[model samples]
Target: MAQTLQEILLAPNRRPKVVEDVTKLVDSEVSDKSGVSGLAVKSGYALIKKINSSFVSDAVDSMLDNFVGRMEPYYASYKASGTGSFTEHLTANSSDVADALLGVTDDRAAGSRRDSVKKVYAKLRPQAKKHVEEALPRLGALVEEHAAAVNTG
Candidate 1:
């Protein structure tokens, strides 16, 4: 049987490292942003971090399971296809992949008690898809790296 992303990534031995890598991926994505919207993203991210020092890591940890769940179908498809990198598969299905990931955040934001956090999320949500789409390649690479690690280790 093929290993699920949840099984590989959410395993107790691997979850922390996956979370840390995801946090770094997010940080890099945010940092690499440019232009007016980029500034907003960077600033909003900074504000959120200031609001809670561990917010990024905490969010990643909390959302990882859902994120992996959302990606499971796509991952399964990639495995079945047996051609092209996961990066390419994610890029080819960028809209669906990005939307699936964002859905997790949207749900989280909707249930958030902190008005400030909600406000920040609201302001950033408009441009989020483009940013997320741009990050898909890196996100794909990150997933592939972890999956490969498990295969080899």
Candidate 2:
């Protein structure tokens, strides 16, 4: 059987790199935004960062496993289909994928002790689905790259 996405991504040696890559992905996604909603995302992200220098990385590290778990079903479907790019598969199912990803953050935000973080999340939540959908291509590519690394290594 093929290794699960969680197993592949959360391996002890690979976890840190995965977290780093995820953090970069978040940075890229946030930085790529524009317009009013984009402004909101950027500002909310900036607020989170201002609260803690390592917040993004720490959040990525903490959320990586949940993120991978949320994505596993889509990954499995993509691998099983053996057709189209993972990016295409992800984009094709953008709503579910975005929801699944957001679910992780929603739960985290609910339990967060930092009211500032929760407030930022709430502010960003309204537009988050669109932003996350936009990110699916790069996110898929990142997952595919990691899957390839495991296959080749």
Candidate 3:
């Protein structure tokens, strides 16, 4: 089992340093936009939300990897005893991260502060689009690297 909420909240690994900077940058961009009286406000909230989503996705991936690692030894022991197939167990549970992340994107996108962040993305939709355009590639690269590591390891 995992730690309690209090422990998780206090855990050092849960903290990602870059989220604040990203939020601040997005808020500042929103503040510079014209005709939007509270673009900054929305941008701030949206940025937080976007970063939160990203963090959640990253956390899910890490968690599933950890879970699988822990399960492997137990699975091997069970398989050696002729209790079950570790491969079957692994495959059945392997969907944890992928399914969770896809659900987060699909269900949470509508709520990602993604669009809202863009709206305040400096009062210019283009600016927001540019940020997202750049961000997606970076995130995609990270995912690719992470997947490669998992596959090879």
Model 2: CA > 4 A from native: none
RMSD of each: 1.0, 1.1, 13.1
lDDT of 1 by residue, 27-75 (tens): 9999999999999999999999999989999999999999999999998
Select the stronger candidate by lDDT from 2 and 3: 2
Ranking of predictions according to lDDT: 1, 2, 3
For model 2, name the residue pairs that clash: none
Which predicted model would earn the best lDDT?
A: 1
Model 3 agreement with the true structure over 11-124: per-residue lDDT tens digits:
345323223333344445445454453454454555655657565335334443343344334344434666434334434444442343343334334454556443433353
The list of candidate 3 runs beyond 4 A from truth reads: 1-127
Query: Using TM-score as the measure, what is the rank order of every candidate, best first?
Result: 1, 2, 3
Give me the overall lDDT of model 2: 0.91
TM-score of 1: 0.97
- As a whole number from 0 to 100, the lDDT of residue 148 in candidate 1 is 90
lDDT of 2 at 70: 96
> Please, what is the TM-score per model?
0.97, 0.96, 0.26
